[model samples]
Target: AQTVTQSQPEMSVQEAETVTLSCTYDTSESDYYLFWYKQPPSRQMILVIRQEAYKQQNATENRFSVNFQKAAKSFSLKISDSQLGDAAMYFCAYTDSGGYQKVTFGIGTKLQVIP
Candidate 1:
Protein backbone atom coordinates (compact mmCIF):
# COMPACT_ATOMS: atom_id res chain seq x y z
CA ALA A 1 0.00 0.00 0.00
CA GLN A 2 1.15 3.53 -0.77
CA THR A 3 0.02 6.88 0.59
CA VAL A 4 1.05 10.45 -0.25
CA THR A 5 0.89 13.32 2.20
CA GLN A 6 1.11 17.07 1.63
CA SER A 7 1.50 18.73 5.01
CA GLN A 8 0.61 22.21 3.83
CA PRO A 9 -3.00 22.63 2.77
CA GLU A 10 -2.29 26.02 1.26
CA MET A 11 0.74 28.07 0.18
CA SER A 12 1.46 31.51 -1.20
CA VAL A 13 4.32 32.91 -3.30
CA GLN A 14 5.15 36.20 -4.91
CA GLU A 15 5.49 36.58 -8.65
CA ALA A 16 8.99 35.84 -10.02
CA GLU A 17 9.85 34.42 -6.61
CA THR A 18 10.25 30.80 -5.60
CA VAL A 19 8.21 28.37 -3.53
CA THR A 20 8.75 24.86 -2.40
CA LEU A 21 5.81 22.55 -1.74
CA SER A 22 6.45 19.65 0.57
CA CYS A 23 5.31 16.08 -0.04
CA THR A 24 5.97 12.77 1.63
CA TYR A 25 4.98 9.21 0.82
CA ASP A 26 5.05 5.79 2.42
CA THR A 27 5.25 2.63 0.34
CA SER A 28 6.23 -0.99 0.80
CA GLU A 29 7.23 -1.44 -2.83
CA SER A 30 10.90 -1.15 -3.67
CA ASP A 31 10.29 0.23 -7.10
CA TYR A 32 7.94 3.13 -7.60
CA TYR A 33 7.53 6.53 -9.20
CA LEU A 34 6.87 9.85 -7.52
CA PHE A 35 5.25 12.73 -9.30
CA TRP A 36 4.03 16.30 -8.87
CA TYR A 37 0.95 17.36 -10.77
CA LYS A 38 -0.68 20.74 -11.20
CA GLN A 39 -4.40 21.24 -11.63
CA PRO A 40 -5.54 24.71 -12.51
CA PRO A 41 -9.01 26.21 -12.47
CA SER A 42 -9.82 24.25 -15.63
CA ARG A 43 -9.11 21.06 -13.69
CA GLN A 44 -6.47 19.51 -15.91
CA MET A 45 -3.80 17.38 -14.34
CA ILE A 46 -0.44 18.46 -15.73
CA LEU A 47 2.70 16.56 -14.92
CA VAL A 48 5.28 18.83 -13.35
CA ILE A 49 8.05 16.34 -12.78
CA ARG A 50 8.70 12.68 -11.95
CA GLN A 51 11.29 10.73 -9.97
CA GLU A 52 12.11 7.05 -10.03
CA ALA A 53 12.94 5.28 -6.81
CA TYR A 54 16.03 3.69 -8.34
CA LYS A 55 17.47 6.93 -9.66
CA GLN A 56 20.13 8.71 -7.70
CA GLN A 57 19.50 12.03 -9.39
CA ASN A 58 16.45 14.16 -8.78
CA ALA A 59 14.11 15.16 -11.58
CA THR A 60 13.70 18.65 -12.91
CA GLU A 61 11.74 20.29 -15.69
CA ASN A 62 12.62 23.88 -16.47
CA ARG A 63 11.85 26.00 -13.41
CA PHE A 64 10.16 23.07 -11.69
CA SER A 65 12.36 20.72 -9.75
CA VAL A 66 11.99 18.00 -7.12
CA ASN A 67 13.96 17.23 -4.03
CA PHE A 68 13.66 13.46 -3.85
CA GLN A 69 14.92 11.80 -0.72
CA LYS A 70 14.27 8.08 -0.92
CA ALA A 71 15.66 7.45 2.55
CA ALA A 72 13.42 10.05 4.12
CA LYS A 73 10.48 9.19 1.88
CA SER A 74 10.18 12.82 0.94
CA PHE A 75 9.63 14.39 -2.48
CA SER A 76 9.19 18.14 -2.44
CA LEU A 77 8.61 20.42 -5.41
CA LYS A 78 10.48 23.68 -5.94
CA ILE A 79 9.04 26.17 -8.31
CA SER A 80 11.47 28.87 -9.42
CA ASP A 81 10.34 32.17 -10.89
CA SER A 82 6.79 31.66 -9.87
CA GLN A 83 4.15 33.16 -12.08
CA LEU A 84 0.39 33.67 -12.01
CA GLY A 85 0.01 30.53 -14.11
CA ASP A 86 1.77 28.59 -11.40
CA ALA A 87 -1.11 29.19 -8.98
CA ALA A 88 -3.07 26.00 -8.77
CA MET A 89 -3.88 22.89 -6.79
CA TYR A 90 -0.71 20.83 -6.65
CA PHE A 91 -1.01 17.11 -6.06
CA CYS A 92 1.72 14.70 -5.10
CA ALA A 93 1.20 11.22 -6.53
CA TYR A 94 2.76 7.77 -6.42
CA THR A 95 2.58 4.54 -8.41
CA ASP A 96 4.42 1.27 -8.25
CA SER A 97 6.40 0.01 -11.21
CA GLY A 98 4.92 -2.38 -13.76
CA GLY A 99 1.47 -3.50 -14.90
CA TYR A 100 -1.70 -1.56 -14.30
CA GLN A 101 -0.68 0.24 -11.18
CA LYS A 102 -3.10 2.51 -9.40
CA VAL A 103 -1.82 6.04 -8.71
CA THR A 104 -2.31 7.29 -5.19
CA PHE A 105 -2.66 11.05 -4.81
CA GLY A 106 -2.37 13.41 -1.88
CA ILE A 107 -5.19 15.71 -0.76
CA GLY A 108 -3.32 18.53 -2.56
CA THR A 109 -1.98 21.96 -1.66
CA LYS A 110 -3.45 25.09 -3.12
CA LEU A 111 -0.73 27.53 -4.29
CA GLN A 112 -1.53 31.20 -4.53
CA VAL A 113 0.74 33.56 -6.44
CA ILE A 114 0.62 37.09 -5.11
CA PRO A 115 1.32 39.87 -7.54
Candidate 2:
Protein backbone atom coordinates (compact mmCIF):
# COMPACT_ATOMS: atom_id res chain seq x y z
CA ALA A 1 0.00 0.00 0.00
CA GLN A 2 1.07 3.59 -0.64
CA THR A 3 -0.08 7.17 -0.18
CA VAL A 4 0.54 10.30 -2.29
CA THR A 5 0.29 13.91 -1.26
CA GLN A 6 0.30 17.15 -3.22
CA SER A 7 1.00 20.11 -0.99
CA GLN A 8 -0.13 22.72 -3.48
CA PRO A 9 -3.84 22.96 -4.17
CA GLU A 10 -3.40 25.58 -6.86
CA MET A 11 -0.64 27.59 -8.49
CA SER A 12 -0.17 30.20 -11.18
CA VAL A 13 2.81 30.87 -13.44
CA GLN A 14 3.51 33.42 -16.09
CA GLU A 15 3.79 32.50 -19.72
CA ALA A 16 7.24 31.24 -20.79
CA GLU A 17 8.32 30.87 -17.17
CA THR A 18 8.73 27.72 -15.14
CA VAL A 19 6.63 26.29 -12.34
CA THR A 20 7.41 23.47 -10.00
CA LEU A 21 4.66 21.33 -8.52
CA SER A 22 5.49 19.46 -5.34
CA CYS A 23 4.49 15.94 -4.43
CA THR A 24 5.48 13.37 -1.84
CA TYR A 25 4.67 9.73 -1.43
CA ASP A 26 5.15 6.89 1.03
CA THR A 27 5.46 3.21 0.28
CA SER A 28 7.14 0.08 1.62
CA GLU A 29 7.86 -1.39 -1.77
CA SER A 30 11.33 -1.06 -3.29
CA ASP A 31 10.50 -1.43 -6.94
CA TYR A 32 7.76 0.80 -8.25
CA TYR A 33 6.89 3.55 -10.69
CA LEU A 34 6.12 7.22 -10.06
CA PHE A 35 4.17 9.38 -12.41
CA TRP A 36 2.80 12.88 -13.04
CA TYR A 37 -0.45 13.01 -14.92
CA LYS A 38 -2.26 16.02 -16.33
CA GLN A 39 -6.03 16.10 -16.65
CA PRO A 40 -7.72 18.82 -18.62
CA PRO A 41 -11.36 19.81 -18.35
CA SER A 42 -11.97 17.06 -20.88
CA ARG A 43 -11.31 14.65 -18.00
CA GLN A 44 -8.53 12.53 -19.45
CA MET A 45 -5.46 11.65 -17.43
CA ILE A 46 -2.45 12.29 -19.62
CA LEU A 47 0.96 11.05 -18.55
CA VAL A 48 3.39 13.93 -18.27
CA ILE A 49 6.40 12.16 -16.83
CA ARG A 50 7.41 8.91 -15.15
CA GLN A 51 10.27 7.63 -13.01
CA GLU A 52 11.42 4.11 -12.26
CA ALA A 53 12.44 3.61 -8.66
CA TYR A 54 15.44 1.54 -9.71
CA LYS A 55 16.74 4.22 -12.04
CA GLN A 56 19.21 6.72 -10.74
CA GLN A 57 18.67 9.34 -13.41
CA ASN A 58 15.64 11.59 -13.24
CA ALA A 59 13.02 11.25 -15.91
CA THR A 60 12.56 14.07 -18.42
CA GLU A 61 10.42 14.82 -21.42
CA ASN A 62 11.32 17.91 -23.39
CA ARG A 63 10.38 20.87 -21.19
CA PHE A 64 8.93 18.60 -18.54
CA SER A 65 11.20 17.06 -15.95
CA VAL A 66 10.88 15.25 -12.65
CA ASN A 67 13.05 15.75 -9.62
CA PHE A 68 12.84 12.39 -7.90
CA GLN A 69 14.30 12.02 -4.44
CA LYS A 70 14.01 8.36 -3.82
CA ALA A 71 15.50 8.39 -0.33
CA ALA A 72 13.27 11.27 0.68
CA LYS A 73 10.20 9.79 -0.99
CA SER A 74 9.60 12.93 -2.98
CA PHE A 75 8.74 13.51 -6.62
CA SER A 76 8.19 16.95 -8.05
CA LEU A 77 7.26 18.07 -11.54
CA LYS A 78 8.96 20.98 -13.29
CA ILE A 79 7.34 22.51 -16.30
CA SER A 80 9.52 24.94 -18.20
CA ASP A 81 8.31 27.59 -20.65
CA SER A 82 4.77 27.39 -19.39
CA GLN A 83 2.09 27.52 -22.04
CA LEU A 84 -1.59 28.23 -21.86
CA GLY A 85 -2.30 24.66 -22.87
CA ASP A 86 -0.36 23.51 -19.81
CA ALA A 87 -3.06 24.82 -17.50
CA ALA A 88 -4.77 21.85 -15.92
CA MET A 89 -5.02 19.57 -12.95
CA TYR A 90 -1.85 17.62 -12.31
CA PHE A 91 -1.83 14.44 -10.23
CA CYS A 92 0.97 12.43 -8.76
CA ALA A 93 0.50 8.68 -8.92
CA TYR A 94 2.23 5.46 -7.98
CA THR A 95 1.96 1.88 -9.17
CA ASP A 96 4.14 -1.12 -8.54
CA SER A 97 5.28 -3.26 -11.39
CA GLY A 98 4.39 -6.39 -9.53
CA GLY A 99 1.39 -7.44 -7.47
CA TYR A 100 -2.05 -6.04 -8.18
CA GLN A 101 -0.65 -2.79 -9.60
CA LYS A 102 -3.20 -0.60 -7.94
CA VAL A 103 -2.74 3.07 -8.70
CA THR A 104 -2.64 5.51 -5.82
CA PHE A 105 -3.18 9.17 -6.71
CA GLY A 106 -2.77 12.51 -5.00
CA ILE A 107 -5.59 15.04 -4.68
CA GLY A 108 -4.00 16.98 -7.55
CA THR A 109 -2.82 20.54 -8.09
CA LYS A 110 -4.43 22.99 -10.44
CA LEU A 111 -1.95 25.07 -12.46
CA GLN A 112 -3.04 28.33 -14.02
CA VAL A 113 -1.07 30.10 -16.72
CA ILE A 114 -1.17 33.86 -16.79
CA PRO A 115 -1.14 35.47 -20.18
Candidate 3:
Protein backbone atom coordinates (compact mmCIF):
# COMPACT_ATOMS: atom_id res chain seq x y z
CA ALA A 1 0.00 0.00 0.00
CA GLN A 2 1.16 3.54 -0.78
CA THR A 3 -0.02 6.79 0.73
CA VAL A 4 0.85 10.46 0.18
CA THR A 5 0.42 13.19 2.77
CA GLN A 6 0.44 16.98 2.38
CA SER A 7 0.34 18.60 5.79
CA GLN A 8 -0.48 22.09 4.53
CA PRO A 9 -3.95 22.39 3.18
CA GLU A 10 -3.36 25.90 1.86
CA MET A 11 -0.39 28.17 1.07
CA SER A 12 0.24 31.65 -0.25
CA VAL A 13 3.15 33.29 -2.08
CA GLN A 14 4.00 36.72 -3.34
CA GLU A 15 4.46 37.41 -7.00
CA ALA A 16 7.99 36.69 -8.22
CA GLU A 17 8.75 35.07 -4.88
CA THR A 18 9.16 31.42 -3.96
CA VAL A 19 7.07 28.96 -2.00
CA THR A 20 7.49 25.35 -0.95
CA LEU A 21 4.76 22.76 -0.51
CA SER A 22 5.52 19.77 1.68
CA CYS A 23 4.65 16.18 1.03
CA THR A 24 5.51 12.78 2.48
CA TYR A 25 4.70 9.25 1.48
CA ASP A 26 4.85 5.69 2.80
CA THR A 27 5.29 2.68 0.62
CA SER A 28 6.73 -0.84 0.87
CA GLU A 29 7.94 -0.78 -2.73
CA SER A 30 11.57 0.05 -3.26
CA ASP A 31 11.20 1.37 -6.77
CA TYR A 32 8.60 3.98 -7.55
CA TYR A 33 7.82 7.34 -9.11
CA LEU A 34 6.95 10.45 -7.14
CA PHE A 35 5.25 13.44 -8.72
CA TRP A 36 3.79 16.89 -8.12
CA TYR A 37 0.74 17.81 -10.11
CA LYS A 38 -0.97 21.17 -10.43
CA GLN A 39 -4.66 21.69 -10.97
CA PRO A 40 -5.75 25.20 -11.77
CA PRO A 41 -9.23 26.72 -11.79
CA SER A 42 -9.66 25.14 -15.20
CA ARG A 43 -9.69 21.77 -13.49
CA GLN A 44 -6.77 20.30 -15.40
CA MET A 45 -4.12 18.16 -13.82
CA ILE A 46 -0.74 19.34 -15.02
CA LEU A 47 2.49 17.52 -14.33
CA VAL A 48 4.80 19.92 -12.52
CA ILE A 49 7.77 17.67 -11.81
CA ARG A 50 8.73 14.07 -11.03
CA GLN A 51 11.44 12.17 -9.18
CA GLU A 52 12.48 8.58 -9.49
CA ALA A 53 13.05 6.72 -6.27
CA TYR A 54 16.24 5.16 -7.67
CA LYS A 55 17.72 8.57 -8.45
CA GLN A 56 19.45 10.60 -5.81
CA GLN A 57 19.25 13.84 -7.73
CA ASN A 58 16.04 15.78 -7.47
CA ALA A 59 13.94 16.78 -10.47
CA THR A 60 13.32 20.33 -11.69
CA GLU A 61 11.21 21.86 -14.42
CA ASN A 62 11.75 25.56 -14.96
CA ARG A 63 10.09 27.36 -12.06
CA PHE A 64 9.04 24.06 -10.52
CA SER A 65 11.42 21.80 -8.58
CA VAL A 66 11.24 18.96 -6.10
CA ASN A 67 13.25 18.00 -3.04
CA PHE A 68 13.06 14.24 -2.99
CA GLN A 69 14.44 12.33 -0.04
CA LYS A 70 13.98 8.63 -0.51
CA ALA A 71 15.19 7.71 2.95
CA ALA A 72 12.89 10.14 4.66
CA LYS A 73 10.17 9.42 2.15
CA SER A 74 9.68 13.13 1.63
CA PHE A 75 8.94 14.89 -1.66
CA SER A 76 8.35 18.62 -1.45
CA LEU A 77 7.75 21.07 -4.28
CA LYS A 78 9.41 24.46 -4.73
CA ILE A 79 7.95 27.04 -7.04
CA SER A 80 10.25 29.94 -7.84
CA ASP A 81 9.33 33.25 -9.44
CA SER A 82 5.78 32.50 -8.57
CA GLN A 83 3.17 34.00 -10.80
CA LEU A 84 -0.58 34.49 -10.62
CA GLY A 85 -0.92 31.54 -12.94
CA ASP A 86 0.86 29.43 -10.36
CA ALA A 87 -2.14 29.74 -8.07
CA ALA A 88 -3.68 26.30 -8.10
CA MET A 89 -4.30 23.09 -6.25
CA TYR A 90 -1.08 21.15 -5.92
CA PHE A 91 -1.18 17.40 -5.44
CA CYS A 92 1.54 15.01 -4.37
CA ALA A 93 1.29 11.61 -5.97
CA TYR A 94 3.02 8.20 -5.99
CA THR A 95 3.18 5.25 -8.32
CA ASP A 96 5.11 2.02 -7.94
CA SER A 97 7.20 0.34 -10.63
CA GLY A 98 5.21 -2.82 -10.21
CA GLY A 99 2.62 -3.89 -12.76
CA TYR A 100 -0.09 -2.18 -10.74
CA GLN A 101 -1.14 1.03 -12.50
CA LYS A 102 -2.67 2.80 -9.54
CA VAL A 103 -1.47 6.28 -8.61
CA THR A 104 -2.18 7.47 -5.09
CA PHE A 105 -2.60 11.20 -4.53
CA GLY A 106 -2.63 13.46 -1.51
CA ILE A 107 -5.51 15.61 -0.32
CA GLY A 108 -3.81 18.54 -2.09
CA THR A 109 -2.58 22.00 -1.10
CA LYS A 110 -4.14 25.11 -2.57
CA LEU A 111 -1.55 27.74 -3.51
CA GLN A 112 -2.47 31.40 -3.75
CA VAL A 113 -0.22 33.95 -5.38
CA ILE A 114 -0.62 37.52 -4.20
CA PRO A 115 0.49 40.51 -6.14
The residue-by-residue lDDT of candidate 2 on 5-106, one tens digit each, is 999999999999999999999999999999999999889999999999999999999999999999999999999999999999999999998979788999
Candidate topping lDDT: 2
Q: Report how far residue 28 has shifted in candidate 3, in Å.
A: 0.9
List, residue by residue over 34-86, the lDDT tens digit for candidate 1.
99999999998998899999998999899999999998999999999999999
For candidate 3, list the clashing residue pairs, or say none. none
lDDT of 2: 0.96
Q: In model 3, which regions exceed 4 Å deviation?
A: none
Model 3: what TM-score?
Answer: 0.98
Alpha-carbon lDDT, every model: 0.95, 0.96, 0.95
Off by over 4 Å in 1: none
| Candidate with better lDDT, 2 vs 3 | 2
Error of 1 at 20 (Å): 0.4
Ranking by lDDT: 2, 1, 3
